[model samples]
Target chain A: MVSITEGKPLEHTLEQLSTTREVTILSCNTCAHYCGTGGRLAMDHLAFHLNNNGVTVVGKELVTKVCIQEQLRGCNHTKTIVLMACSSGLISAKEAWPDAVIVPTNSTLGIGSYDPDTGSATLLFPFPGHETSRGARFPSLNTEAIR
Target chain B: MIMTLRRLDYHALIAFLPRDARVLVWSCNTCARLCNGFGGKEATKALCSMLAEDGLEIVGGEVLSVSCFKSVIRKRLDRADLRMMAEKATHLIPLTCRTGVEMMRNELPWLEIVEVGETVGLGYLSESRGAVLTNSIVEMLDLPDEGIPLSEVAEDLGLFLGPFER
Candidate 1:
């Protein structure tokens, strides 16, 4: 289990990257993948949505572990990075390319365990202010639409 | 870092196992290790010795870098030698966070896993103060701006700190 995160509503994410051009989607395939927020599928869905909305997606980089600085080395420095990872991975991306604008698509809820048997991740340990969300089980984010 | 506190003491832990239990100890060597030797190679070795001295059948003890990851733990347990030892064991003592324990349960469904650690929350290592829990999931705890020290949390909650002491 890793950092448990939730995807922000697609509208919110789009609004955050509204003015940016030549956007690069940086997705974490580990924790965010398990959370159903920032994997290959999530990145592609977001990219498709952004493209249809007239936002140009220049490139897409899928990292196995985005929290590690070395994983971000291969990502090209773009004008705007639509990062589909947790807060930690976002920080790593920021540190990797300080000049580029980083836009996060998810909120780091806290740390939790993913039960493959149940196919849902339980929020066992939420972050400081998110204490009320303990023991909450989250299913995969709906990707049928950009809403 | 993932902060954890001891769920049971040595005596309580011993009571959980039967008299003829063939125990296998599996520990996580990452976050739990950084949480002041709660679970690591050193703790695994110490627990094995202690359990052996107490007359338990210590089939084997192993420590993985990150027990939470399926690939890392599956590879270790799939090894011929470890598999043989695991087959002989009836119970497993997991010295890891809840996620790691879930991974163990998924991997080894036959063996009964005796959980002995409770995951408190996420924390970071401080230069001056050691492991300080910045964010806690324990709703009862009211944290300060700088967060509370893990040692204080452990003591306040009537939980044991570090490795299990006999």
Candidate 2:
């Protein structure tokens, strides 16, 4: 997923937002981790990313499960919410706080299978309009062979 | 660093079985799904495959979310079509997580149970390098190999499942 800031692109969207606004990053510690995003470190990294960019991040929280309604009460109302969770999770969080401007830092990817080897979640499919980049060392298939 | 914890209760349930007992396998369709443990038909299939490979006869296999509910499980057991299979089996091996395992154990105190797979917990070890680690702990099992390339496995599984939108 990508983040937009003031109509300009930034290398790390979370860092960019922290720099531009008073931000309180909220993460759903459950499924986000499964999706390879969200957690204490992601929150800290984003905070640091923002700090380096001159954005002041006031606070953060790694809710046990953001999808659970009870945990929503723990969110602090100090600044705009930069949610580090799946799209479905963001919707739930938004419902809990109608006044907060909730911005999603990650895109909602589809169900992923766990690779016993890598411990990372690879998207089951390439997103629409996104071309899979061939590795530098791999031989490129000839167009003629395709035809 | 995949973190896995084997539920001790599950081990106890399995230990109750007689040596080389014929068993039926089942799994939950809920929490196990979220935990990445075997669930649904896939879970039942995996248990059958593993048990067969280990020289155990899997008399029958089924997948149900409420297998622990006595009324439900009992009704299935009483079915005329499954009477023979149920009679031949010495135990029921539910492939559910620790929670489901406990529920089943409470309802069927005499049934044998076994849980396989590990719970995976992940976190970043360092923010400076953006290094993440997954720790998996098996309840009563040890790894024969020092390390397994989990990233490759995750990648292959993702690709095998087909392309997904981010």
Candidate 3:
């Protein structure tokens, strides 16, 4: 039900997650897939982009539904998990695999064209929403912020 | 996972059904499952029920974990009950993406494979608003709102009890 538009540079995302070791990208094939942010086709393109950027993408997984606890259990032994899904999917992955370092691939510009800098929940078309820190918030992401 | 699915209209879907044609439903829990477009176990059951009510013979039905995966669908067809039913089934109605319909067709070359859901595009699901179809795919497919956009077919059937998991 949540909608997000993001256009963060792929170069930055690659530099953050693709470190010395292999990086595993968990592309949500469900919600985010529908949203065109992450899906099999998008993940494949991302992997292609990352590989071209000198990042070693060990694997790209199309998690059927990253929000589901059961599907979240498929995390690999790889150290990093790059998420292409929304915040809800990230939370589900965190709960399911507490040890894996998670990083979001996109920086949400906001629902529709609204900037996150102004704090207000936008409800359009009865879409379900996820609670997030508003006001141009950046998801805590760093190449060294691995857990 | 959430898939953006639209149902097929029943009137157009069954127009070519021959007399005494035995139908077996097959749906994928992949893209079709993501969208409420009649792509899961519940959809298959509901389709079978609707066909039965319409005086059609439904031999059997199953929700394949990945109907688009040719090998998996072949394995499903290899099941004793499914194989037996498929032997007698004259047609296969797949409530799945275009890939799924083709895979089913390849798997069973003799049976007539029917598509009940148009693979519009990849999509998202909101707990509050249900299925949301993105624009990229809509533009890619060049779909119009009228003239048998498959989901409307299932909507016309009006027997689905859904939002079930893949």
* Highest DockQ against the true fold, candidate: 1
**Model 2: fraction of the reference interface contacts it also forms:** 0.00
Tens digits of per-residue lDDT, candidate 2, A16-86, equal: 45445677878766556544366776567667766666666787888866644456675685547877765
For candidate 1, write residues A1-147 as lDDT tens digits: 577888888888778877776788989887788778878987898999899888889999999877555656657758888898776666556656778888898888899876555557778767867789888776445543234
The runs of at least 3 residues in candidate 3 whose Cα sits more than 4 Å from the true structure, single-residue gaps closed, are: A1-11, A14-64, A67-147, B1-7, B140-166
TM-score on alpha carbons, each prediction: 0.65, 0.42, 0.52
DockQ, per-model, please?
Answer: 0.17, 0.03, 0.05
Model with the higher DockQ, candidate 2 or 3: 3
Candidate 2 segments exceeding 4 Å error: A1-20, A125-147, B1-25, B28-166
The DockQ value obtained for model 3 is: 0.05
**Per model, how much of the real contact set is kept?**
0.21, 0.00, 0.00
Over 4 Å off, model 1: A68-75, A91-100, A117-119, A124-138, A144-147, B1-22, B29-57, B63-91, B102-116, B123-134, B140-166
The lDDT for every candidate, in the order shown, is 0.80, 0.48, 0.57
Candidate 2 local Cα displacement, residue B40, angstroms: 11
RMSD of each: 5.4, 18.3, 13.6
Which ten-residue region of model 2 chain A has the weakest summed lDDT?
A1-10
